[model samples]
Target chain A: MRFGSIIKVALRALLRNTMRSILTALGIIIGVGAVIAMVSIGNGAKAQVEAQVASLGQNVITVFSGSMSSGGMRGGWGSAPTLTIEDAEAIEREVTGIVGVSPEVRDRNQVLANGLNWNTSVNGESPDYPDIRSWKIASGAMFSDQDVRSVAKVCVIGKTVADQLFANGDPVGQTLRIRNIPFKILGVLDSKGFNLFGQDQDDAVLVPYTSHMKRLSRRTNISSILIQAASADVIDKVQKDITEVLTQRRKGREPDFTVRNQVELAQTATATTQTMTLLLAAIASVSLLVGGIGIMNIMLVSVTERTREIGIRLAIGAHGSDVLMQFLIEATILSSLGGVIGILLGIGSSQLVSHLNGWPVLVSTASVVIAFVFSAAVGMFFGFYPARKAAQLDPIDALRYE
Target chain B: MPPVVKIEEIHKIYESGEVPVHAVRGVTLEIERGDFVALMGASGSGKSTLMNLLGCLDRPTRGRYLLDGIDVSQLDRNALADIRNQKLGFVFQGFNLLARTTALENVELPMLYGARKFTTKQIRERAMHCLDIVGLSQRFDHFPSQLSGGQQQRVAIARALVNEPQVLLADEPTGNLDTRTSAEVMGVFQKLNDEGITIVMVTHELDIAHFCKRNLILRDGVLVRDESVSNRSFAATELEKLSSAEAAAKLTGAKS
Candidate 1:
């Protein structure tokens, strides 16, 4: 017999019980729908995190003071001021794949300017600090290395500081008081809304490290060092070289610095979302499995319910294979039809979520195709047993069944 | 020409419980073309079993059976199914029409399972023609539930003829119908037999057996009698008599 006619016969049988067919397909529909929605949301979260990581900097590496251990006393990363100016200079001189280096020192203090006072963080950094951090100066140029050498009392304010202290006037070349000492503002940095840590990045001031250590805070050791590699491919090499140099410089003492690259931080940031996406997808697959079982259950019931019908077909020349194909095709049709509907449901819900909450959702073509094929295969896998049962029935016995 | 069905001492034994029950034992039979035969027996007498074997619905445990010049006794299940599809047709006592299906589609069912491929238009045309032959053309679009008992039997007969099989087997075809409807259905079979279609039917009713040209009686898993009828009954005359008798009965009851 032609395959088309066989399909036609299966479809007619399914149509005879429309409500049962639809209910049987519902399992797959919900399964695929959940998988699509969950995966979309998870992907959106991962993508958002990756975008944030990119904003931190390109090909950048940071060295924070490791948990310091001296005579059994310890502190967490960044708690100890262990980095010195000589270490920064040594890295810049010895590292071959680096583009820039900036020694960093930070403190939070109440500052007064334009007859108003606000408390904010004050960071002391080198001339290459803005370049290494991928931050741009909006109005005035960054302080020169000559300024750092002379320990010039010059600084630049962030957008938040500029708004607070220099709100009524151009902040460039304005004088701001820090720790009861006056420093000239060189420029206003461009606005960077926030970092991944949810901290307001623009709520701070920048000054030469020499001026910060010698004039403002009056501390010797630095808190951290930011280094920029020439390219992404050279970051690992540069980090290794810096660690070696630091370890060698501090021989006979425990290593007091921790090295991290931009890529590693991004991976750390995205790992949670990745795990979440996989976990949600795995749970959704359970529903798909349930859907497949539903198909199998309905198919078994249909076979038993239609034993007499099967007998009639067999008596009138239908091959056992023909009967088997009819039932198998019925199941496949149910699942594949469910698959298509589930895909639509998934896309619709994800789009709705993206619209209502403004979350970035991506439903790639690959996911859609995979879900469809998987549902179809589920139908086939679960359908085999019942079809075989129907095919193996004795025609005479089936005919005589009440 | 070879006989349509030639059975050589076919035996069917069921090993369901401890003691094996021989349903049909050494039942040898031959049916020629264009002949209408009724197989008669009481319950458990093996007539139904023999009919099943003849219809290819079951295989004999020991026998060499030939159908339309093909040795089908040794054929596998699939091969037997193919033979049935191409060369045999069946009508069950329940009228076994697929529920919720139109008469036209029911008639088209056998052709769909047959090895011969047909275009959609051709399948429809053939199904319509069979319904026309059975005088159910007007009710072609009606479901089995929408049809009367006799009308449904006629539709079943139409379905049996759709694939143009070599033999049409009916197992107690009129078991579910009233006397008048049974006569009406017998009329359709008589007409088809007159057109040279071979028919084998199982029935215990003496009157129903009289409608066929020959009768075979089974007793205790064996064929006890096989003979051509000397005085056959015509369904046309029987139906006329039944309606007239009903008319007279209605006339006599009016006074009461």
Candidate 2:
């Protein structure tokens, strides 16, 4: 018979058993929905990690002093004083791949602005600090190099500090007291949002490192160093150069410091996110397998129920392939319907979850296509046995069946 | 002249476990073009087996069977299906119309299976003509469930005649209908036979068997009698008289 007639027959038969068809399609619906939802959540988590790593800035390296032991005391909270302003200056002047360098000395203290006091970390650094860390001034202007040279009391406030210290007033060129010392706010840094580590980037204060050491603390030592490479391609070489310089400055005691490259951090985060995506997809694949099994079961039942109809068709001059194609088409229609419903549910559920949890959910076209194709394949793979069985049935025996 | 169907010493054995049950022992029969014949037998008398063999639905075990001059017993299953589609049409006791299809579509089914590339309008026109022949022109779009037993049988007859095959083989066509409905269906067969189309029917009712011009009676896998029914014409008056008599007998029996 014609292909259209066969499709019409299959569709009619499926509609005859509406409840059963819907129930069978539910398997595929759940399977595709799980796949999309899981992938979206996994991708969301990966994006969160990516944003965290990107917050550190590309082509940048962070150097921190290694922990130290007190004299004859194990497990002491002492840290080696290896990083210094001189080391930072040497890297900037001698390293071929160095773009900018900033030595930082940080301390936490209560700050008073217009009689509204708040406790926040104050980081003392040079004019290149914002450049090395990829922080931009949202308003006013960044502290100039002349301010660092002249031990100027100008400072830059983070968004959180700006919000807490000034409320509705513009903090630019306003005086704020840090550890009882009055300082003028030069600018407010842009918001960097929150990261995976839950650290709020908009809650610190920046000032000239030289002034903080000489005038505020009466010390010339630096705690950490931030270095920006000329480009991502030369990050490793620049890191090696900085390591050598720090080692030499520390008197060959293995530099007593650790260097962290943002490239490595970003790569690790990417690998972690991809692994998570695969793992979630794998878990979702189990549902597809179960859906396949459901299709197989339903097809087998359909074969049994339609044995007489099959016999009638065969008696009326239908070939075995026609019978096989009819059943196969029925299976395909069932699963395809399930796939469409599942896609809608998956997208809606992902959006709902994202809204409720305040997490980012991504639904890529690739995921949608993959889920739909997989569901159809599952239908075919599971529908084959029943179709073959129907094709192989003896016409006489099938007609004789009640 | 080419014979419509020829069976030569055909044997069919049914195996139930290790024992063999011979359904058709060694019987040969020939039906010519435009001949209206009936196979009469009780249950398990092998007449149904002979019909199946003639229809190319089952192969003879040790003999040759030719349908429209082709040796159908030697052909493969697919070849047999092709022959059935091209040369033979069938009606069954159960009126096996696809339950969900409309009457018109069911009538159009065999033509769809044929090799002719007919447009949708042509197919519908032909199907409507066939339905008109079977006196079901008004119920073209009704499903099988919506029709009565007699209407469903007429629809089945329409389906059988849609392809205009060389032979129409009906196995107990009126087995499920009442006596009046059965006579009405037999009238359709008689009219088609008068139009020079060959028909071979299997029926157990002697009254129904008298409708055909020839009869082949089977007894225990063998032909007991094959005779021409010269004075057994199926006149409408005779059928009405017989049906009234049957109804009167049933009424008297019920009263007793």
TM of each candidate vs. truth: 0.92, 0.92
- Fnat of all models, as shown: 0.84, 0.43
Model 2 residue A230 distance off true place after TM-score fit, in angstroms: 3.9
Q: How would you encode candidate 1's per-residue C-alpha lDDT over A151-264 as one tens digit per residue?
A: 998888899999987778898977889988898988999998789999999999888999999998899989899999999988899999999999989986988889989998
Candidate 2 chain A, run of 10 with poorest lDDT: A73-82
lDDT of 2 by residue, B1-256 (tens): 9787888898999886598989999998889999999999999999888888888888888898878888788888878777777788889998888878899988888777656678889899999999999899999999999999999999988888877889999999999998778988999999999999999999999888989999999999999999999777575876667656777888533322
For candidate 1, list the clashing residue pairs, or say none: none
lDDT of 2 by residue, A69-114 (tens): 7787544221666567777888788888777888888888788998
Q: Write the per-residue lDDT of candidate 1 for residues B84-159, one digit (tens) a residue.
A: 8789878878999999889999999888876788889999999999999989999999999999999999999999
What's the CA RMSD of model 1 in angstroms?
A: 3.1
Best by lDDT: 1
